[model samples]
Target: METTTATGGVDEPGWDVDPDDEIASVVEALGHQQKRWREAAGLGVAEFATAMGYGEDQVRKVERGARIPRPEYLDRADEVLGANGFISAMKEQMAKARYPKKVRELAKLEERAVELSLYSNHNIHGLLQTEEFAWALLSTWRPALSKSELERAVAARVARQSVFERSPAPELSFVQEEVTLRRPIGDTMVLRRQLERLLEVGQLSNVELQVMPTLRGNHPGTAGLIEVLKFGDGTAIGRSEGAFASRPVSSPRQLRVLELRYGIIRAQALPPGESLAFIEQVLGET
Candidate 1:
């Protein structure tokens, strides 16, 4: 059989599966199933690697559940082992396993939200961030991340932007501090693109983007960021850096407090129209 070129070239790095992750068991089961299929087909690791155009080490890692297989890896394996579509069908689960656990949890909440109230005091909110800006901001994490970890983080953050494309789009309200816009997270070009992105998303009918000037001192948001997400079923979840130890709270009373703070923050900021104009001015100055 001719080797398929679907594995992104030979021996491409695979995603390390975190053993402590909730999805770890699922990945391990999939890997075990793949191994069983390979054995049933009378293929050794080396033979399977050659058939799939992957390195022997990569094949071993995938079969051992030490790595998260890419979609193409599963596809190539299915084709090689003649499992019909059985092996390939696990791609969907593997896709979710590829992201960090925290990101996955937050994404699930965002997916359920019908309305999101967000205030960012230091940096642009993740949903409204450009890929470049996200990368630059994440790169500054104090402990630093490995290359693979950083790439996964950036992808996860960008994936959250899909909320904007949902049918019957969610209502998204964002309040960004003035310094967030003026601060160059990456380079001038990166910040410029990020500002331009804000303008684009701000114009969406379901989105309200406002900027809180730095001059507004001692405001409710001065303590920190606040986020409240309301779902269609009347249930809500919220968190504030300055409240309840910054833990996510689902109780009505706690949510009300967060909502109140967010409301005031939005009211204290420039109106949406003026915010867009301010962003444009910043873009021009950039």
Candidate 2:
């Protein structure tokens, strides 16, 4: 049996939350494995879906693990597709899947990013979030966690900010919808401290803050938020839970679409010089 030795009574890393989390990751692992098996077998999703007595849509969902494959479904799929043990092996990996895969990808990207650009709709972007904000946000998730879990989550999020202080720090730019400033996430004090932090943050030459106003008539990004990242290699990617539907889009076609919208939004937004004043204005309003 594998052993986990404690150091000063601290739990070791790699422990998972629950069966659900493990199952979630396995769902993804299964999906990827199934896709590989299908390719090796020279089959298409539609063809495989038909063979397995499932619709194309359901097949896609199964592969993505957005929908669990019922035991009967899995048995039939395994029999028809010849993926003998893939689904069963996911029991451990699924525990890691409770969180969204896109979220985990974003975390990894943030850690390695040399620059990050943010645009938000309903809430403050994660990189700018404070402990109180993060705790409140995570606590509101369904299948609620205990206080210790929430703290761990909050700490994990806050610790991610250290990338900002690394040698030759990454550039950070934020574009927030004007409504966020008025939302009042925490109480007055928390909100005030947050806004003050924003001011201090905005003062950094490597950081910029911009606000998109309601007055800027409806446009592309009017639908949701986006984040564009430029990495150390100087390759850039654009992401929005929007157009390519939240998938990581490094393709020129997708990036151009997002790039065009981001450009217009920036133009309609208060420029950096005015943005400082705008942040101060909201701070005064609080």
Off by over 4 Å in 1: 1-9, 36-43, 75-89
Q: Residue 202, candidate 2: how far off, in angstroms?
A: 0.5
lDDT of 1 by residue, 131-231 (tens): 98999999999799987788788877887888999988999999999999999789999999999999999999999999998998868999899999999
Candidate achieving the largest TM-score: 1
Question: Each prediction's TM-score against the native?
Answer: 0.88, 0.63
Please write out the lDDT profile of model 2 over residues 1-286, one tens digit for every residue: 1122232211111222333553456566677777788877788987886676556666676676555444455566667767777655554333324334335566668867887878898787777787776676676788997654555456556756766777788888788888877776767877777778778778888887888887876766676888888889867887897778687789778888887888887777889879889989999989
Clashing pairs in model 1, backbone N/Cα/C closer than 3 A: none
Q: Give candidate 2 misplaced runs (Cα > 4 Å).
A: 1-103
